[model samples]
Target: MSDSGPSTPPSPDEKPAKVQFNDNFAGKLILPTEEEIQNDPYRRRASSRRVSRRMSKALAIADILEQERQYVIGDIIDLDTIVEADDIEEATTRTRRFSSVVAASRKSQASTKDWRELEEAGDESSGEDEDYLIEWEGPEDPKNPYNWSKLYRFFCLFTVSMQGFCVAFYSSSYTAGIPGMMAEFGITNRTITVLGVSAYLFGMGVAPLILAPLSEMYGRRIVYIIGMASFTIFIIPACVAKNIQTIIIIRFLGAVSGSVGISNAPGTIADIYQSADERSKAFAVFAITAMNGPPLGTIIGGVLFRYLGWRSINYFSLIAAGIFFVAGFFVAETYGPHILREKARHRRLTTGDDKYFSRFDFPPATSLATLLRRNFKRPLKMLFTEAICLAWALYLSVIYALLYMSFIAYPVVFMGLRGWEPQIAGLGFVGILIGTSAGVATDPLSRWGVRRHKVDPETGKIPPEALIWFACVGAVLASIGLWIFAWTCDPGIVKPWVFCILAGIPYGLGTTVVFTNGWNYLLSSYSIYAASAMAGNAISRSFLGGILPLFAPKMYSNLSPAIASTILATLATALMPIPFIFYFWGKHFRERSPMLLALAAQSGI
Candidate 1:
């Protein structure tokens, strides 16, 4: 009382300074602004200011009861904390509003960048050809091949995959037409069959060197459309050819068109997916399309050959080629350097700035010699020097040869031994269909393995070697199929048709692994020359495919089905481990090999 002195009703200047707390705070609160009021050791005073009565009472009891009373900052007993309701309705409302604002801001930012880059990426030049040829910036650039609009890109993907299907189908379907072709051309069965299969392979092998490089120099869409169109046009001659050699020439030319599938399709898929994991899945899809065509075409060909005549096969191909042509018109170009170079051209035109050209742009009036040098040397260089590329190509070639052999041998086996009709014998090829399905069925397991394991820098997430297990399993099945066809092939016991089905297990599955793994490893190691590498591979594989089938009949005649199959199976068994070896060791080999070193030097890797 003496010191307080009736609180000296402070002067106007000294009146209790207003204590400002945060906004939305209420009166009678001990605000931080007023030192005197904040530090005042006064007992609690009642005021008109409202408080949660429950908290106030609890605080009072807590102080008086002195149950080890300890002071605490913040509301020691918050009414909100004690509340029974799960929702902090006010806080939740505020938080949600804040989050919405943040999310919108982020979306706006991303959208701004996405649109800017996409518009910039799409700008292609027409006048100056210098900007038309250059290496792409990278995967992140909107101009990158993988960054294309999904619809346009998917169209290309479908076209590439379907091309593989069409080619594979065409190759096998011609087998069904062998007899008719022979009769019409007045040639021996062996010659017609050889031309039918061999011409297709020859096309497969040779077209790529010319076509793949041309496509690279120009654009993938142009080559694909032109190749398929040319192939379709040639089918007319194949359908109506009056002589055997004319049929052979037409078939070879038609195959040249079709060879684009074998050479370019896998590379096209690689171009579309940026990541290795994605490429593997794409390879699987491509593999399915590539592998599925043989049986599917053979079956359809068998039925069509029986009912519609052999000309229907060529006619069917015309329909497919027509569909591909229409689709190609809409396929967006995905070549990386091409897209970037196009962007540079746009920049130059828009700003009158020639300084924006990328280093990858080709100089004006590049010579055909330079182009040929690039096309011929690049893929062959990759094939010869890169262990990864060479191994995979070899493996794929073996598997392809094996698959084609089945096509050539099955007709002879079932028709000659079990006396089955062409249509019924064609059903024997269904074994390959089954084996292919079985191989594809392993995809889920492969995906799971990739998910379960940590990524390996060497072979990527799913080692290409993992694909080999299926090949080995398939090789064994093929061996059994061969054994069955060769041994029990006589009409007396099990039908020859049964042997075809059984043998297909190995042939189909083996080819699946071979094509898929070869494709995967090629892309993983030589991404720069992926298209050319595949094109070259197609050349090698198709050449093998063509050459091997030409001799199939003779080989079977000389060796007997059992002996021929045994030799083939033994070779497959020996080679089956090759994929596995490369899967694990390929990265090291690629890094250490002189061939790879030379390729890297040439490619400027």
Candidate 2:
């Protein structure tokens, strides 16, 4: 070989020679022999192309390795082994292994895959010596709520549910005090006194539109703390208020603060239970507590008002709110994104590295205002645009309206017709409590029904619409109960116990089933946006619950209790078809909805 360095550019007419290397040759620069240079034009072109491609690949691999170093700290790279490789083939082989490891690590970072996928992937790679991403640290990470001890999870669930129960208890408990409030404030119009309760429900509806998103931005703990504390504090003023306006305004504010528990509790349940079956049980308990609170409040309030006085109702709520506030401290943060974000922050601080971040960490570039605007608009947008949300909201709203109207209807029958005192009349609500309990007890049946209709036979995962089966049954019962109660409420027709047991129990069962199933369907269908969907449900239900009672007295008086209630029963009967329609065709509706389609794709349904 000659050591000459200069080579002239080829003319347009001349073809470049190809270059060839020995099988054992390393990637060392070499001068060409005069004979080889003169004869090998095509080989020269091929050699140049090979060198360019290798250089590009090396640069790309270096970039990937650097990124891995920044985000992951471990035996992920072996620089010494690569540097010691004696030939291009050896180096290329090692680089391919590194690339494969990096690709596997990136795949593990993905959050959309279900637990089965993760387990299967683990089995497939059992023999490989690799450093996969540590998303949940082998599924036993204490930080992951899904891995929490059952006792601890139950405690958390109970605490959160209690918070919801307190708010709901206070919502209707005030109704029993309305007489005292009217007399004290010298309010002649019953409508004005009723506004005190309506104002609170309206606040409950509107506040969730803001607070639910705030809980997502901040953690659930902070929201619960602030909300419960404010609620407790506000009760003091309402208890001593001289005017009805003060009571109404303060009650509204208190309800707004307390709304956080109602809005975020379902999301907390989602965090703890990864499977729909487990979540259904939790939701059943939550639904039962929520449904029973109003009736329980009615009972408590009537007793307190009759014996201790009306202001004692506020004192009772104050005590409950205080207990919830203290309990809030022990309730762990169950929001997954919030937990991951905190983990990322801790890791970054401990490692002194900014790149150790969780996938859920919000972008630093995003502004608070932008986050608020997006989150605030999401629930309303879902309510109006998503077919599933719109239909379910309407269904839940009507059911909730009927439930509130029962407070009015019961008094009409037992007090106005039977001439029962307030305390005895309040006992009528026990039928609702019994029915709600019965509905909760049947959740296992609903779960079995869902499994029977599994969308994926292999995985046994059911569609969201599977929940509507309970709703369908509940609707029929509700319609029948309404008609029965309307007709049997007459004084001479049958005993009072007949209406209480036959009509109230079935109505209670039906309403609880509808509420529970509706919530489950919404939560499952919109998992990522569960809170937003819940906010929509709250808005519709509270709005109708508040407005429906305003007309109850007028309705009973103008049309007579039988005709008035029958009209409601007819409407309830008309709505009976809604759950059935959704049960059969909901999937089609979801397929057409862009939002539902995107959510389904994310959840791998």
Candidate 3:
């Protein structure tokens, strides 16, 4: 043998010779022949070592690819092919290329996942480091206002509604103190004193054109707090005012600040409740509180003015503002974009990442001036351009004007004709309160109608027109109530109790249904633009509220109470067709308008 001369053991690094089996040896192992071992002793060892190294390298690459898949794809990986693969280099190359393709596909698809995975994959492909965006962790994320616990949501609703009630209460409550104000100031003209009310209502209408957009930009919480705080603080000047002009000016400013809650409350409710069905009930409660506030405030002001003083009304307002101010602290931010922006800011601060942002984050239309200009003009544009908005605005404005005129009408009927004191006359509002309560109680029926009308038999989706049914029924009821009130206003024709109890109840009931349903319909029809639509409603109502009362004294004096009342009733009867028209033809009108089409698309209608 070649090595026989040495007859030495193999070095430690060298492999031992292998045993081999004969082709047809019948389960017998055959040692390698001496000639074969001498020919290639280390060949099997070298080949085995090379195969082991190659497999280890392939497994390592598979592990890296699997890790990349997890980071990129955000789901479990399938590893059967890599595990079963036989050719190491081929599997490694194929897997590496395939994983890269899968990653690219995932990036391009951008499936809905948490922000973390999207950020990582985005960074990897671009080969540039980027900060992560902040978003809801998932659809059920509790931080989302829509996903908040029921108790918390109700608390928020209650707080905001209370704010609205306080502001609205302030709007008409002080009318009770007007007589005392005239006596104290020694002024003769009632029109001059009524200017206080007119100015306040005008302020309420105009301020929302600006404030609603600010709420959208900043947040509901900040706007509410600042507005309530200013409203509360301004009550002092009005209470101590020595001159009519001073009181009127202070009241206007207070009204301006207080109007913020009115414009923003619907938006907050929309933010909290995404479904029309869910929102209907919340809006019913909201409508009840808002509808009841003026009458309730009149009741409170009558009692306070009789017992305490004229100034006590302002004091009561201050107390209400304080309560809402403290409660405002607990109110969470409800605007979706504002909430997301805040989340983005928190993420950037914590991660020390500059690229973190929200989809809502943008350059904001070049400048603050442009942003404000667009926002300020939006409500006007919606008011004038959209038929749905115009019809609803006209209907609401007329109804609201009639409602304010009732302030004068009630006094004329109860105090002037029936020779009752101011406090007793204020009791006529009890019928309205009863009607509002009835409306609140009947809201479930409206919701049922909405469900029945809106739900697709197959898809279970609600159409926007579903909201108009209640409005239609409300128009009929409101018309009947107006006619009853008009024909029955005379004490000679019917007892005061008859109109007060019978007529006022239906009037209140019909008014509540119309307002609540109309508001809900507008909200549904213009989902993202609901705030601007509401602002339009507010402007029309407030404008009518201010202007209508000025003519109340003349209308009742010039035309007999019966004729004046009939005029209002006739107008109401004429407009009764509005809701019905909208119910049948609203969709066609919406289709015709590009603004409505865009809104419908945004709402996925």
lDDT of each: 0.57, 0.67, 0.67
Q: Ten-residue segment with the worst summed lDDT in candidate 2?
A: 74-83
Cα lDDT of model 1 by residue, 1-605, tens digit? 00000011336786432212223311221122234423543412312121122123322222211110100000011111111111112212222211211212222332222322322332233223224323455546665767777776677788788876887788788888887777766766574557667877777777766764465456676778788778778878877777777777887888878777656675577567655456556666676787788888888888788888888987997788778767767767765545555776787689874545543234333444655676677678777766666776777787778778877777777777667788777888787788787777676664344345333443223333433344445445555555555555545555534554676676676566445435544543433234555656766777777766777888777776666767777776677677557646655675685654643453222
Model 3 pairs whose backbones collide: none
Please identify model 2 stretches exceeding 4 Å from their true place: 1-139, 146-149, 273-278, 347-353, 454-463, 492-497, 524-531, 597-605
Q: Give the number of colliding residue pairs in candidate 2.
A: 13
Off by over 4 Å in 1: 1-153, 270-283, 343-360, 365-368, 381-393, 447-481, 492-496, 525-536, 580-592, 597-605
Instruction: Give all TM-scores, in the order shown.
Output: 0.67, 0.73, 0.73
Model 3 vs. true fold: TM: 0.73
